[model samples]
Target: MKNKYSTLCYQFKQLLNTTLCCTALGMSSASLASTHSLLIAVDGLRGDGIENANTPHLDTLINGTWAAGYKAAFAHYAQTMTDAAPNSGPNHVGIMTGVTAKKSGVTGNGNVAGGNYSTYPHYLTLLEQSNSSLNTAYLVTWGTDMQITNTADLKIDANDAVNTQNAVNIIKGTYSASNWPQGTDIDALFIFLDDVDGAGHACCFTASDDGYVNEINDVDSQIGQLLAAIKARPNFTHEDWQIVVTSDHGGRGSSHGIHAADNYTIPFLVTSKVAKQGYLSGIPRNYDAAPTVLAHHGLAVPANMDGTVQGQNIRQENDKGIDHGLTTYLPFNSNYEDASGNHTHAQVGGGSPELRANGKFGTYVKINGKKEHLTLGKPSELDFGTDTDFTLMTWYRVSGDQVGDPVIVGNKNWVSGANRGTLLLANEGNGDDFGINIASSRSDRKDIDPIDYTFNGWWLLVASFDRQGVATLYAGSPSGELNIIAGDISNVGDINSELDWNIGQDGTGRYHYNLKADLDDFAVWRRAITLSEVRAIYNNGHGSELLSLMNASH
Candidate 1:
């Protein structure tokens, strides 16, 4: 029997999901049953550092969810007093509590003068409270990681191998029939590995260092052993298990705690039957881990959990999708300057990202079908991580007589096969075809039905992609709007930080897919804007109207 509050909480969550689904076309409505969630944290491991190591098992697991890479999210989130310290204390606390260290009162590694474990609630505590019968466990190699544990069912081992072995036993129900029944299962389990961090501190943190690389390999091997053990379980096939792996901050040369990118970045991987295989689209922070696991168990994340659910937005902030996470909004009101607060300046060339004006808005960029583009070199703001959802929008009128593919906006590296960021091309050979190349290991293009845009009046083109590889493309005409499923493609890839993104031309140096049309109000959002939001923008009557709505909403 559930209490009224509990029932209301569940109902409220469902209501939120329903309201959100009504807004976005590509938004996922899939729900997971309350199942087991296993979170493994590798301390002090760099996000990119795994690329240089021999981690066959870890690599194999990542392939099932994120393709082939140790690519990752940020662990050294600056939302706490730790700032860029990247210490295990604050990171692990954030991972377990879903709150900043500042709020959790676990500011530094050592116990705060008056702060106790009860200062902030752990996600496990909340989950257990939601369902008392749900089993939970925490295994760590560092004593400091124990600070985040509020439950008595905790195990600590400084040795990575022993700690993992113990975790394997616990999963196998070998810990004890009383704590873990043979037929029953653990609802949630968290395992922390510290060898990689130890190796980094002892022998240089660089990937080239044999000691550091070897430690990573060792951990990977242990992960393989654990997976094998779980598979050997009698109920393995029947159990709906989800495995999430990440780290407690990355390291620099020999130490961390700096505000550098290398020190803050860490790998985040999820392997499960329901998991999406690609790079996540959002900027995952350490706090997101707790909510992600909680959501996997079909539990409503508490309002205090300061993190984004893996596939769902717990806050429902973008339900309306007016421009929730607007990164770059190039309204082209008068110039090529970005209206989005990021102030991402565009460089005009040939036909110019800064070009001929006159549109529903004050001015527009006109691509003259020549070797011209607007380039933004390595805009870090555009690097929506692997498996993260994002939405792209632009209003444009195409020229009918185009000799090659006309790209509204795209990255040059996409043509070079890097497939970072997004390359939106339409009017291929003619003004009817529309295609998109998402960031992936290889450029996998998804084609939508040919909607003749050649010489067509200004139309609002909105495309959104989610972690599940589902893409929805919308073509909003003055008369009416049409949309189509763009088909699923590899969702695993990151923006090529080494290259430049452009507008009105392909990333290829040859300058193919030039935009031969009038463009206005080009915007990129970190989140996948819903269909209702797209309709709202189109229904606003004019470009300025929509712009005002977006500005006002944001």
Candidate 2:
């Protein structure tokens, strides 16, 4: 009996070894060799739209590469009803330069010589090292990347289309698949789409939502053609042909911005021929990706880079907690239920919670949870002064299936009813059919359409209503702040003198009422705290005592 068992064990081990060998061999074929750049960009793809579309080709392809929703540093392209900055030229430059907008010293779209160039490691390392032998060229309009001077060395800048067709045409004339350069290893073929941006600015997402979406789908189809060409080649293993699709910055109505949600978070998608083998996984910050790409190309990452490289020495920084210089709500420690498991709140999936403190004293929860979280209610409220620059902070978790309204309560000066409170910002599941609604006492204020907040998982919601009388909402900390409407309302629309703002909603001011989600440390302030104050509050949430408790429980 013992001999028979030993023989069986040996057979199983042999099978496992053989399987590993086969798998490694396969990985080497698609990955070990150099990959050809088959990059594509689809404008205005909401982070929420990633999984819903019926586009199976894209769904599968996305799984093949490093994927993430990047943080848009400065979201310009402001709007009439905007609550943030309006022009995002400087933000775009950061992407091309592989640096933060602040570090790059770029705040708008301009080719000024002093353009911020805080060099991103991935762009330089990938081109200079891994694919060092390959020739790279780009075709993009004026915006995010102004560094593309007309060097004439395999580069095309479309400052004026058709009008400058002579110049652009000359560059593309060399792109004939049949007649390619034999000596030069053409590694990357980057393409940028800037038309939808115009639509967002002229029509606002309200009227141009369909147009914006259609434009993206159209670009996707065009990319499908490019993918087909790469696949038809002998050297290309379909998987060896790397396809990356992303935008330098997000868009909104009337203006671009840095502080808007749409402006801060950008889409990142990579589809390789060797998918199914499964690609890199886990939710990483936007900055982390540049380093990851650079590493894959066998290049060294710069230490000063603010982003991260996944699956490496770089760990996921918890900006949500105190350790990372944040304050406010408790660092979204971990998902928990009642000790007796009887609080009755549903389990949240596909999304997590983000924590933030108003460096002074308050919390902001960007609640996007699909299900309800049995959390602490608005047990407290304070007067966030009328003449002060105040900021609101909260840690919210977005539902994987929806972006629900779980925040937005009224104060002494809200709602028409003196005793009424409006808790807006919850999920209708179907779409933005629901939202968080807060009203002030006076009027002349523009109805702010929160620059597209995250509908997927979690992020810190930071509201900066400057004393200068403008409001801005940020995803994480005030890495960037946008301008929203912030003046006293004159009764016609101001609901400031309402009742106790409810989280689940009592059907007060907006379309959303019932909050099927959880909320924590919902706080207020008398004045808008400084950015550093916000960081301190974030840090406070994850106090040594609290972290130790969280870790022990985990």
Candidate 3:
């Protein structure tokens, strides 16, 4: 068995090397030749619409039973743009630009012309700017509602039938126009169909509606036609093709742009030789399409984009059991509610901590060093007996002004030779060190060497305790690097006390040290979490909520 220190070092080194290489090269080093992507956006296609309509092509693609010997597809009942109106312009911009309305400035269909498209343009435009040799095409059925066609070598605005036929002609290398008498090679293509949304707006938007179902069926047939055309290519065997199908938003009776699930839930599907079979690991957002497309072609996803590449770095089946022993989880997303379903909510005392909108994962609680703190009343589940293994972790951002010893989390008094519980402190015998103090009784306390702290930055602090009283502390930086310290505290037999559990100050109130920092994603587990699980939660500085980890594992 590999130790935690060596395993963490190896993982960090490998990740750092990959990051450096990708940064220096400006593109993925695994770029392949003759690769192509066909992204299809079917407007207002609900998750149930596919199941209710006759979509053999979609079924075959999703089930990995394509007669042409293609690999299985990755399907997801994904969510639309979050915290934005469920409108075509905003959702479409999110789908093509990998950003929400907050960044893209396309709040609705009427305001698309005034969007920030120049700064956060479509992925096709980025690709053209990065590599002009790669041919790109854009075909939309709703006229010029989409303003991202500037960089496409072939841009078309027509009805769904005309656009589908043009895409097929392009695939077969028989396309010609007034500007270019000869057809050009196509590498990436985006097709937008709006008839389904039109049908919904005309009448009702339900799976039971015949008009809506008929439009879906027609689109499925069009998709079938496109697939057949791809397989019919003369050099099909030599070309790698990826096909992505999704929708902007769903709707209710003749209307949308609401907060209801019917308007926000949509279907997302991806089929290719290298795609993952069956459903995606987690629920993806509409904005993830652009990054996914860019990553498929070995292009770099720009830092300005807000989307994450789907199906990348997914947790393996064996590692999905990370949440088995999770006892308490505090997300601190505008509240102190416990997300672990344990109901161990924290109570505010003294002055209420300010809830800030920006955090490592979500909203965080801001603590000013002046006596403000949160108290988690003594819960029996948190009291680990003599030899039970446990893990405690939290993400904190220091304000850089430190006075004396401050407690990040503790359940006992911090009196010398009288402590009786575990406390993770910001300073241990020194000003700029993070350490843990575990004690079963007065003389049984143990304080290990503290890890150096960097102020004005976010860091993940984790402490795992084994049945043998051996403790390991892990400090993770924003750069994906880790510093670990281990020590034997077997003399600290039962580090459980009757005092209440507190955050940002000592529980027993003996020490007036209050932590001046922002905190988020605090959790406790009955069993010690493995090193890989720690890395999964860390997620290379983009910390994940517990629910996301659970969903990925499932």
Best by the lDDT measure: 3
Question: With candidate 3 superimposed using the best TM-score fit, by how many Å does residue 86's alpha carbon deviate from the native?
Answer: 0.6
Sliding window of 10 residues with minimal summed lDDT for model 2: 70-79
Q: Candidate 2: where is the Cα deviation over 4 Å?
A: 1-32, 49-56, 63-88, 116-126, 129-132, 143-146, 149-153, 158-185, 206-208, 272-289, 310-554
What overall lDDT goes with each candidate model? 0.63, 0.39, 0.76
Candidate 3 per-residue lDDT, tens place, 1-554, comes to: 11222434534654465567777878553442268899999998875577667889888887777645465544324668855888899889889999999998888888777778888988898888878757788889886455653577778889999999999998876777743223455789999999999999988676557899899999999999999998897667667888888889877778888754457667777777677665454446678889888988998898999887875333123343767878888888778888887888888966668888878776888988888889887898789878777888999888675678888888878765366888888886557677878888867776644556677788898887754534657777775555454545555678778887888877675466777888888998887665567778887666777668877876
**lDDT, candidate 1, 152-229, per-residue tens:** 244455578887877788777665433443323456888888889989999776555789888888888888878777
Better of 1 and 2 by lDDT: 1
To one decimal, what is the Cα RMSD in angstroms of model 2 from the true structure?
17.7
Off by over 4 Å in 1: 1-34, 65-84, 112-119, 177-184, 311-554
**Ranking, TM-score, top scorer first:** 3, 1, 2
- Model 3 residue runs over 4 Å out of place are 1-33, 67-69, 313-554
**Per-model TM-score on C-alpha atoms:** 0.50, 0.47, 0.53
As for model 1, its CA RMSD to the true structure in angstroms is: 18.5
Candidate 1 yields a Cα-based lDDT of 0.63
